[model samples]
Target: MSLDFVNTYSQLINLSADADPSTFYSTEDYRKLQTLGPSLPTLSYPFPSAEANLVGESTIDVKLKSIRPPFKFTTELKAIPGSLSIYKLKNQLIDEVVSLKEAGICASNLKFMIKSKILTDTTTIGLLGDEVSITVMITQPSHNDTSKLLSDPEPELEAPKSISKGAWDKIESVLSADLGPEAAKIAVSKFKQVSI
Candidate 1:
């Protein structure tokens, strides 16, 4: 069974935040997370299609410079197959991070560098997609006494590819069978349609 693309991606993002970066990054879990990034455009599809079908591709690059104490990073977004105003999207992201800080989920050390651009006009009845690549690096804070000690090297381990596949299957089954068509439709109705 196939999972909702957006939900899967969202879950992956949350999981990454909760899991140890070394373990998550070294395993196939990270690769599966990358797959979710590319499907963003398709997942953003608005319901009740007009006479003309909209299609486009976008690429998002996220770099996590640090994940300890204070998170720092940069992101770049570029539309490849359609014209898109990314200012709103960028603002939304920053707002979310700020909200997290306000809620005490993250420290005030959070910082982001963002660059976005629209590339081309949308094409009708064509393929629309997005590719996202994320790089993560975790560093010890300068103020920490442990920073003076030698960093413990991550243990070499085989990447567990089946773990993610199993997770996907479990999530797909629940979403497909438990939600029901009506509930899913109602949920989708809540999101505002975006103009490509």
Candidate 2:
């Protein structure tokens, strides 16, 4: 049998705290997270009507970033059958992160919005009727070192990608390997969805 999907999902649930996960909804912060505002209309995947439907509830995965605090975090969501909307689901995740931050369970970080789309499958017709589940993976700056910005904090320097490419690549490699090829690719894909 294929690797236990639940096991994969479990791993995602416990993704490392070093990812700087947090919930901040301000536009400026959201843009800094590299996300275009939430999709005009939140996507929704209505509960399947048939009881026999293989809803794939067990496959839903959630991953946190893998870097330390004093940073911002973004969660990129992915799904199969591009039509399967999960904007609300992402919002809920954001809310959870925020609550966790408020409770001191999680730290404050730059907030980011999620972008959702179906995976490699092209058959869009009735895609939602099939086994579809949404997954979230977090992205964050590689280091908490803001020394460069401190000396000359310019609007250009505010963007992390320009300053953190090398560090981000290293973290991405370690994380991708940890997630395994397939899952790692999915996570990376989600990362690109927002980053682009």
Superposition error at 121 for model 1 (Å):
16
Candidate 1 Cα RMSD (Å): 33.5
Provide the clash count, candidate 2: 5
State the lDDT at 38 in candidate 1. Answer: 29
lDDT of candidates 1 onward, in order: 0.41, 0.45
The per-prediction tally of clashing pairs is: 1, 5
- Worst lDDT 10-window in candidate 1: 117-126
Taking all chains together, each candidate's TM-score versus the true structure is 0.19, 0.20
State the lDDT of candidate 2 residue by residue for 37-99, as single tens digits: 223333465765644354533233333342334333544333422332344343445565664
